[model samples]
Target: MKRATSIVALALAALISVYALFLRPKENSIPSPSPELLAAARPLDTYDFDLVLHPDSNQLGVTMHACFQNRWSETLPDIVLRTWAGAYASPETSPAASDELYNRCYPNGFSEGGFVLHDVTINEQRVTPTFDDAAHTVLRLPVTNFEPGQWCEVSLRMVLTVPDCLHRFGRSQGVWLLGNCLPILSVYEQGAWRTDAYAAIGDPFVSAVANYNLTLSLPERYTPFTSGIFEHANGLYTTTLHAVREAALLVYEQSVTASIQADGTRIVCIGRNKQQAHKPLQIAKEVLKYYNQTYGAYPYPVLMVAAVPFAFAGMEYPGMIWVGENLYGQGLDDALELTVAHEIAHQWFYALVGSDQFRHPWQDEALCEHAMLHYVRARHGAGAYDALARLRIAAPMQENIREGITPGSPIDSFHDLEEYTTVVYGRGAAMLQALDVHTNGRVDDFLKEYVRRHAFALASRQDFEITLADVLKEDMRELLIDYLDTSM
Candidate 1:
């Protein structure tokens, strides 16, 4: 009897070990946020998505559930969403169709891709949504009475075809880039929804702060780099993002990754190999540390920098940034470091303090460019900062002023990417530099105060001017007019 009992106990122990080895779920690699952070996020809108990837068909099946509250004073007539992926459905309307971006975006030539809405539901009842524009980027859902302070739930079933291109929202070199692919709630201001067109010139996305819960399933070999803290269980990956403007994910077969801690925030870098990953990881760590000390503490818990097949130097989302794969190659060390610093600055300028990128593209872009100067000054020296300022900002602005392009002009006012970058990024930074001189180099203090005031809210051009004036305790109208409004 004793022998038999021991045998049964040993068998049970073996079964438990097997379960631990194969059946038990993997723990979260990232640490949980503080309770205060979690509590602060509870009041924002919530988005939940269940996504499945089909590599064979180059498709993704998505089911989205979102809850939004009417925080506005007046009642709303309908809900508007920006279906940005729909812009890829036709070459005629696609942003990649431009002569400058065509070859670089579609390396193997363009293949058809876009969102196909299967069904939609509002308040648990089936509803029809209207495509309000030619590109089908703006979707409107009618409601009888969306009263103020009322909450609404929206559900959508859709499929996305991954385009065979090297762009941010396409597939390249067996990797899938999912930047701004989700249909998100449109920003409503002044008694109307912002239904901006998907322009090719600059980053045209503008959104409010929200929380996201994403559940993703992919093929056995593929892994996803997401813009949130995530864990894996039962063949599914779940992510949680708090108070972010948008979420981005990059899917690939494999990657070399490294992580470092910066003021309690986990900074992860992903690349095709160790050589590609290590340098960027170190650069990100330094940049984040500098920004935290200079401006304020980073709000999010995790920040990821992933190398992707993209034409641009880098693209910024809420918690994740995509660094162009080419920038990781040999002899581009300065470019890689500068790009990393620029994108990391966006975490404060764009992610933490929201802005209308479509209308005032300079707000975030120019701030980020100037932040790069600060980082250079702190890390290298004042001489390095001045050289970068002269080469990147002063020279470019002089040439752009020749064309009479105002740095604060609307995105549509620029005809192409060159003009857009020259004015918005170059001259815009020049404007801030001028302000720095006028205020006796108090721009850093002003930025710190600005972030404190508009941490998770959208700030318009007027808000920016007001904040600067308040910080300096002086009138800035003439200075702003000379730099931003009047060209040269």
Candidate 2:
């Protein structure tokens, strides 16, 4: 009897060991970040979110607990948050309401969508939040006697009505995009809060990096592709993203996936089927390899690319990117490759090296375009690079110059998407190309140094100029003025 009991105990111990080693969650197996990266991410704000998606009702219920420290020298009064999804509540406020976007965004006509705030608490004390705009996109919460270096905890409960549209923050065909839907803390700079309106042109967003802990519950059939490494267990999906401007998720009913590793970073591509996902996955792997060699290593552990019903060619997030679903069809091979390369470049330019994309759209957009040129030169040869430069950059830029349109103009300065793309993407890239010529093709080296200096910090126009001057050992004020200050 004693021997039989000992044998049963031994079998139970082995079964427990097997489960711990092999059947445990995948997130537990993820490698830890470098000590330097961890130290840089420790001081920023942190958000804990519990999200429940009701696909049948087209709504998302969220409970958020945000802890943020006042980093400024002097701080009092209130904290502000940007409820970007409110911009979709009506046609007048929607960025996609423009004539060029309305039809593409709302194939089934307009559907109202916005956040319905239920309650708010600061340090466990109940408080009421106020809306600073008619659209209710800017929310302010009054805090009592908050001081610098002191941390504040905010809790919120809200429900978001997902719009039926093809744009970001909406549902289209069986896929739902939850981009910029959460109420994110607003930027406070130079002794005041930056309450920039949601402009109808360009990507009108400016934010600082924050750590995110998110748990999402979706319907049984739904699968989510999110911004960070995630694991599934007991019908719940959990994710953790460190040092990202925002967390984005794309939920779909079904997907065919492909994955590859480039320089220790895993790249996953998801589409409706294998035919649509394989090519982009290969392109993403190639681009990641090139950028890692050219600039620096990608900061994140995993990068996800998903085919979405987006109006644009692609959209960039911290650890994820959305490729347009339409581009998956045949005869659009060039478009697909270019889009993948450009968005991957954003991982370096926009994600790792932070900037105010709203105020200085050229900072990231133009740099990505410039990086794309180098990628073309390396992968497709010098002849292909030259042809692409002439067709995409030089021609459109010349036209913008002829029209007296400045590439350095803010998003509000442009009347429509066409003009904004022509100036910011085309002409702005031309300015960088000119810099490459002036520096004897040393712009790549300059950018590598820039990324090293500003990784995980926000950079300004002045900062960029100073970094370039330091890299080249000569002042570039005159050349920058020629392109940024004057149209000619």
Candidate 3:
């Protein structure tokens, strides 16, 4: 009788264990958290861009209405538009026309690309728009008697001649990389318009956050990767985005793999084939998750990654990033990973916490590179990160330091691409790392608090210093004078 009772107990235990191992339902590894809700900052500028792409002619017929409200105490009398494409007028006129970066857009030459402003209207009245040919990038319109707290609408009809290459704003290999193709309103900074010329060096763009409602009409065969909520219907695609410095679109004929992040963000990866898209899709997902966890939750609903055949490794827009197809093939896994991670970091640094790229590119570039280092360490382990730092950051920075170059120089202060890349990205990251050491690993906390405080706001060097000081409970400006030059 005792043996039978023991046998019955053992049988029951075995059945329960078997059910737990094989038959019971499994729970999700990473449970979805409640969505983080935050209000968007009120946009001071809004743009309504209607563009039609003529792929065969490599041209865009555009009608843009830009509305501006006075963010200042004083009334605004005039507005300036940056016709960036005009910089590609001709090699003889534009110094950067035949440069490598410019040629990336105009592979053949500048003859294929330029901007032509046809008409301008202010408050439903016809007006003349001044196009500066020598500068090749300014369009000024007078807004007389425009009062404070009043909205002024400036309408422009223009033709954008897309070049036959790939850089920022051109066509490359049957795909159109439409970045900075539209007439961007110059940011009013330090009580004046920021009309920086299109330099051959760094990204010569400076703009304030603006709301965009862009409608694109193109062929059905193309899938457009845009920097906003892309809605396609009736052979037209429209996108609406808020608090973005610039809007971008990449129209391509490729396959896209879509996935949903744990935070309910839509991620689309476009590439020539499924295999090409799969790896990047996976990388982007991991990076996205890590960033959302580290910084604030990404505000936008969709994030698009398009692999375009371009020269540059990657370019970050507001909600979309163009990953160069060159990073797809062999012997470039590290480059691919670092590039994707860096661009994703820009979602937080450049997109959410806006910085003056023209004046202090280091604020974003260095910080993004540092964040990428953290991602590499988290994903691949410490040894991999150490190797990456040594290869990408340490060596170049060592060379730059030996050359007596300051890490916090302006965009145009550097002589060439190599110096700029080394000083800004490498040494700038090194400075951040030094700060981490000085703060006893409080850099993570400091950065998170910084993002929370300055989300969707333009952050200057002073703002960064003040935020850091607040975090440390002491002034950090003098301590980090070597890193952030206030003189600039």
Candidate 4:
């Protein structure tokens, strides 16, 4: 009897060990719901933003609530606001300078990319606003000399114009949506501030306060899609927005498909009125469902995608994707679906959780690329994504390419076609694949945790690495960096 009892005890011990090894969360980890599940719950913070479109003036009245944190460096120059001049010129061929031509579509003396002061309490003597031209940004203003860590409701109103009709300027000239309309604070990471990689401008850092509510009034013929909730609408195209989490508004052509999903998510798109965009529409619905099933439900409960022509090859706007003629021009089969999927991936990587587009491009952008590839793999078969990843690794990096090596090389520097191809886009795609291999399938859970922990906070590269290490194993450090930093 004693021997029999001993045998049963050993069996139970073995089973318990195996279960723990496979199912346990990390050390000191917070007990929380899975991302797939947590997404169904309410978010901790909410923000409200409004964009009053002015097609006649060729500008947008950009207003934002919530708040901001100022951390501009002393050395950078004051950001030049307004329409970008010759922004489409090739980065390699164009002169190394930044200048914007004001279209004067909106009211003047609104403080061109600079700080402005409205009426406050005279006796209150609100904190005086300050701007250092040398830093290229507004430092910090007390506003009301309020207590530290106190939430003060502040609003910034500005006017922005589209530069050109073909690219980014299309948002101004064409009937479409405009993203990143308001200027906030820049991220101060790794000892200095982070700049934007796409525009060669300063980084606007405010990831924590992404929650926002926005309302836009538009033509009856033009339907508007925004980031936050849509409370009610009146004539002339109106929507009341709330929970301003990130800064973005999606504008789409009145045509296309518009409907309320069963999950309470509003899915809209602007594509071929005929059958060309049908598959993309179907694929889009599936992608959204799959995203909720695999990771988490979209907290906003509303996602809008507009198919439109953009300056860049493809641009990811907050609520919609400015699908370019180049994309649909490629035809609406695989290429179009791939492009759409990539943009949808951004809704999570770039939209929900903000990243410093100016610096640390890999942190969120690469992750989005990886996430996109995962979906591509699912739709086309895993082998396809794996093969594409292999092609990326095969393309070697050019150490000689001017200044991809500086401490912040490629971080804040604007990479045009040539530079963007090798580093930001192609290499980033490859690195994600490599990271997948490094995690040994452990990334599934890590990503689930990552978006959960830093969903609405400023996350840095170091923070990502450390979190990854903690979630999996400290030993993964060398493995992850080896694949990400090096050619192999």
lDDT of 4 by residue, 1-488 (tens): 99999999999999999999878643222223335423422342333446676666556665555443233333322222211212223322111223331222111212122123333221233334443333323333344343323344544455665433333334432455455435544444554443332343222233444334456766555655554334444653334332333455555443555343524455655553544334456767877776665556665545656565543445665555656554565444666776777777776666556665555666655666667777877777878877766654345343334543321234545444445445665566665565667667666567767777766556667667777887877646665555445532
Model 2, range 182-264, lDDT digits (tens) per residue? 98999998877778888878888888899999999999899887876568899999978889989999998888777777787
Sorting all predicted structures by lDDT, with the top scorer first, yields 1, 2, 3, 4
Shift in Å, residue 209, candidate 1: 0.6
- Model 1 scores a TM of 0.93
The TM-scores of all predictions, comma-separated, are 0.93, 0.93, 0.88, 0.69
Looking at candidate 4, the ten consecutive residues that score lowest on lDDT are 105-114
lDDT of each: 0.88, 0.87, 0.77, 0.50
**Candidate 4 at 319: error in angstroms?**
4.4
Off by over 4 Å in 1: 1-28, 400-404
| Least well predicted 10-residue stretch by lDDT in candidate 1 | 23-32
Q: lDDT tens string, model 1, 1-488?
A: 99999999999999999988875333346567667558768899999999999989999898999999998988888999998889998888788877888988887787888988988998988888999898889999987578999999999999999898777688887679998888799998999999999998889889999998999999989988887766888999898898889888898887788788778888888887887678798899999999998889888888899998888899999878889988987899989999999999999999999999988999999999999888989999999998899988878866834445688788978888888888889888998899999888999999999998998899998899899889999989888888888877
- Candidate 3 regions off by >4 Å? 1-38, 41-43, 92-111, 132-135, 400-404, 484-488
Q: lDDT score, residue 333, model 2?
A: 92
